[model samples]
Target: MSPHPQEALSTPRAAGLAGILFGLLLGTAIVLVRLAVPEHPASAGAWLTDSSRRSAVQAALDLVPFAGISFLWFLAAVRDRMGEREDRFFATVFIGSGLVFVAVLLCAAAAAGGMLATAGGANQQLWGFGHSFAYTLLTEYSMRMAAVFAFCTSTIARRLRVLPRSLVWFGWLVGLALIGGAGNVSWLELAFPVWALVVGGYVLGAGSGRTASG
Candidate 1:
């Protein structure tokens, strides 16, 4: 007899491949952004004003493609494993947070643009406010991004039951990491790409077709 059509889509092997690819792409982009940052001047405001600053911003923005693609792949994987009908909540968790992610990035771009327009190589409240607003929005979505993934992962794990309990708890840790980005430790933002990568491996390597709840 043939395997169930759904079975093929939900197989551990397929999810594993997708997750690895997602991790590789996301991790690569994070590395690219981190490397690009050092090339930029220390002041966010100063960097925003210079032509060189624009280059750095462009380079950073380029990673959006990788991030966006990883997010899409994750969504597809979710649909395959969980079924579209039953997993609408997790679906929203992933997609809604993604929409917010894009919004925050756009806000960041706008904030930088505002700074570029106003800075006279000195203090400008307009530009500073814009950048601050952008960062605030970025922090908000960044936190939400971590949380949404945490919930989505748990929901999937609960259904699939392939992952060990300890690994599942790590997903919650990823969510907490985002909270630090909101405070003085903004550099901690680097953690997510790695977290996503590991989670990608876990989801693919460890998951059963039907999570425990399912």
Candidate 2:
């Protein structure tokens, strides 16, 4: 058997990887659309021509795979604690996050539609700004802040028995720091890439091992 007992323990890294991939591709889509949009280098509508919009849509589709893979990964990790303490709190965070994600997605789709409808209009450039702003807000709400809360809670529940309380408490504090953007531009966002890297490394280290359902 593989060394790790819980799939949830392996989840953070997986979830992190999914978030990174989504960020990379979605980030690229935004950049490309911005470049192509008319009347603005910064506007997403510029690059989002019919063809580019299709590309952006595809990029958006990519998020499903990214999130799905991580979701399963985290699911495995959290399986052990499914009904334990703090599990319900994480559920609350997930629910809030889903709401935020849906709202942001609606905003993005609307903004994309506006850009397409007003391609030739001069005053409609606001659509691009709307997309970017909504993107930022929703992403922060869904992935960054919510993620920190979820991660800290999961780790605390995991470490409550053996790990030092100081370590567990520090993790919770770091998670809070990540959510509040304590040091700079969202420590959560910054930590995501690192978190992904760690997961990828761990999965790699567990070379030839398989993820089995218990």
Candidate 3:
């Protein structure tokens, strides 16, 4: 009945690719930040003075905007794939959490950028504030929102039978790790991107299979 068979098949493919891109970009940025910045900003501002660390932080900040953009596309593509099957209640949480995560991510990037710009300045207090603010936004706020988004997406995928049981369970574990310990554990943030990578790979493979069958 549909006129555009290719168009009908495109949404899942788009979602899969976008999710993969987002996960890679975001994971790289997070790794860069984790390597360059200290867990406690107040401990020492030595990274600001270290050229290599400063360069790594700068590179991380540069990747964040692109990662955020990719995430938006991934969110849109996933929502489009869900179509009429999406539950309004879970959908609201999904959309809200994703948007908030992007917002928090960007804000953290801006804070980090400001901190870098003021690295050579006389205002040590401002630098400390910015450094603390950026990490707080990233680890505390952004990750929590990411947890919510993951949970909602997994629930929707399970309901629609779009994702496998293994992925759904993995997603729940990712969500739990993020919400429960991401701020306390520096490495836990990687779970979100890793989960995204797995989900994206599966979705892309499934889409390819459908295209072949069609």
Better of 2 and 3 by TM-score: 3
Work out the TM-score per prediction. 0.66, 0.48, 0.96
Better of 1 and 2 by lDDT: 1
lDDT digits (tens) for residues 27-51 of candidate 1:
5644544443332233554444456
Instruction: State each model's CA lDDT, in order.
Output: 0.57, 0.46, 0.89
Q: Quote model 3's TM-score.
A: 0.96
lDDT of 3 by residue, 1-214 (tens): 7649799889888888988988999999999989888887575467877999989989989999998998898899999999988999999999999999999999989988887887777376776777788888999899999999999999999999999999999898889889999689877888888888888888889899999999
Q: Which stretches of model 2 miss by more than 4 angstroms?
A: 1-61, 64-122, 157-174, 182-190, 193-214
- Which is the winner by lDDT between candidate 1 and candidate 3? 3
Q: What TM-score would you give candidate 1 relative to the actual structure?
A: 0.66
RMSD per candidate (Å) reads 5.7, 6.9, 1.3
